[model samples]
Target: MSHTTGADAKGHYFVPAASNYSTTLSIGIFLMALGLILKVNAMPEGAWAMPLGAAMIVYVLFGWFGEIIHENLNGSYTQWEDRSYRTGMVWFIFSEVMFFACFFGVLYYARRIALPELASYEEALNPYMGFTAAWPSSGPMGDPFTPMGPWGIPAINTLLLLTSGATLTWAHWGLIKGNRSHLIWGLALTVLLGAIFLGFQAYEYAHAYSELGLTLGAGIYGATFFILTGFHGMHVTLGTIMLIVILGRCMKGHFSEHNHFAFEAVAWYWHFVDVVWLILFVFVYWL
Candidate 1:
């Protein structure tokens, strides 16, 4: 939103103020997505707009979120505001869930339906595709690329995220119990774990590309695997950043046993990301 929204004539309704942030955010997101689509399809235009949009979005998020925090510190949010924020956060998470579902659904359709149909076609009619439908499959035009195993970095990442979740919960408990040290320690540990997970993921990507011949162009297998895990990694990065910010807030004597909606909201988002990664681990890696 461009400005604060609350307290209208209709029994405490939302009010919308005109601001450029909304328009900027929308345009930047549109350009980013458009650039990505075009670049993915090998367009010849200036596809660098994607990174430009990404940079704009980062700037916007920081500015807008900082404004919100300032408002909160000034005692702008009330119980009613908290309720509204909770609802908004819930819907936001649902949107993210739907977003990831589309990718997972596409992966499923490709593996279970499209690949089978392509494979079952007559060899005389479709001689190009040396088709065989298999899990962790490279499509007919793909190279003989090897898939990654779950027993290595992925498994380690799984444990890291799972432990982060536990630490986050411990932090939440500490917050509710008025134990600031415990809360700060837990958040610090969680952030450390998240960074370790990212480090391992980077190494895994290097290993995959250099050793296993698993570049994005390696075929459907590589595309879906990277798309899923790459997006998840981005989410983890964002979540970790959020935790770091919240940790800073905690250190500065922010949040309380009774009022910490911001902290709770970020924790909810972190847990949601964690759950999504678990599903990805099992479906994309082990399965």
Candidate 2:
């Protein structure tokens, strides 16, 4: 339970005593992944494993993060540790950028390369000679379905997210100026906007499935549309949860103008989510 002993005169970085948190978390992750694979394959034993794994992961994370927060509040972290955290967050966001980049790559290949190539060879294939390679195409065997337009729920959600980004920045300004009320109110508004965005997205998905016949099974266009938007919605959910946590901390006066890296880190993540959504709006929905 001992945290890093404050800064050493020898100038060595602080290394805390070992704990079993990582090992336990790894076991939980393994169980969760195995359960998912099994359940997808219709194995009965997976029913219990998935929830059990999820529970373990949640419990361990609460305990681990609680301990770190305590250590941070107790002044265990130094300039060196702060720098390391900044670098780690930078890399984490970079990895996320790459993750989405790969998905965008998939979308590009499907539309610009694969579909066009398929069109060129359609006559040669004979069976697919009737197929028309086009943007928002249902495959040759796919059912007729209306593609989603960009002007309705998607446009509203775009506005909501852009507004949330501005509100989050306002909260940062409040934090920097030591205005507790301003910070808390800004964060509260940001969380609300985020929740509203998600709700609208959920409704959009339901409409797609029920009315538009646009679904994962609807063909390649439907699959890519849902995949990109769905993942972005998940990220928004996570960002909203983080915003709520930061709001609680702000209420407790856990941060000062100078010591607010937790706030900054969450801000960085939220901004990344906003940027990604803009790209998605353009490529996946607008165009």
Candidate 3:
């Protein structure tokens, strides 16, 4: 517990002491997912699960990260450990890329192949009665609904995200240049921009459901629209929280020019979010 280095006297690789963080994290994720499923099915039991799980996750993250921060400040980590962290983050981002790719694939298949194939069938042969294969269509039995247009909030949000990316890059530059004020200001602006983007998205969702008659049940278009955008919004929320934490650290003089992998990791995730949003805007909104 009092060791000054991540390794022991024998110079073995560092292995952290076992903890319940992973177990609790798993439970939290499970409960949250279960709660979503239950609520979507209109079940009343497990109504409290999602919020409780979210609270648990927040608690775990704070406690876990606090311990790690302490360890880092104590000079416990070595170059090997830093390299491992970077490698792990890279793989994690790759997994996320694949996750989104699957959803995008589904959207592509539905739009390009599946819908047109359905359209090719004769009326008598069509199972969907009056189904017309069209982009932004609700299936045959789907209710009448206006599709969302991209020029309004979506366009604005895109600009906000792009600006946030630039601001974050400025913050990184400030960190490297040892300009504390610049770093703090850049991070602050980036976080503000991310918050504004989320706010606009929320308003857009409300408008979609209320004015445009768009919802998950609005069939393929609505489902795909929400699925893609909703997940991206969630990522933005997480990224904003991470930025806020980084801002707090910056104010406290936590990172040096050469030793800020945590900041770099968050920056990587933020940039990934920005790229994903650009693709989403093009394929889901513009197209």
lDDT of every predicted structure (CA atoms): 0.88, 0.89, 0.90
Q: Tens-digit lDDT track for model 3 on 97-183?
A: 999999899899889988888888887887876566778887655667898877988899999999999999999999999999999
User: Predictions ranked by lDDT, top down?
Assistant: 3, 2, 1
Estimated TM-score per prediction? 0.86, 0.95, 0.92
1-287, model 1: which lDDT tens digit per residue?
Answer: 43333332333433334557777888889889888888988985436879888888888898788877877776655567788899999999999999999999989999899888887889888775566787788787877788998887899999999999999999999999999989999999999999999999999999999999998887899999999999999999999999999999999999999989989999999999999999999889998
**Model 2 poorest 10 in a row by lDDT:** 1-10
The stretch of ten residues in a row with the least summed lDDT in candidate 3 is 2-11
Q: Write the number of the candidate with greater TM-score, choosing between 1 and 3.
A: 3
Off by over 4 Å in 2: 1-11, 122-124
Better of 1 and 2 by TM-score: 2
- Considering only N, C-alpha and C atoms within 3 Å, which residue pairs clash in candidate 3? none
TM-score of 1: 0.86
Of candidates 3 and 2, the better by TM-score: 2
Task: Kindly give the number of clashing pairs for every candidate.
Answer: 0, 0, 0
lDDT winner, 2 or 3: 3
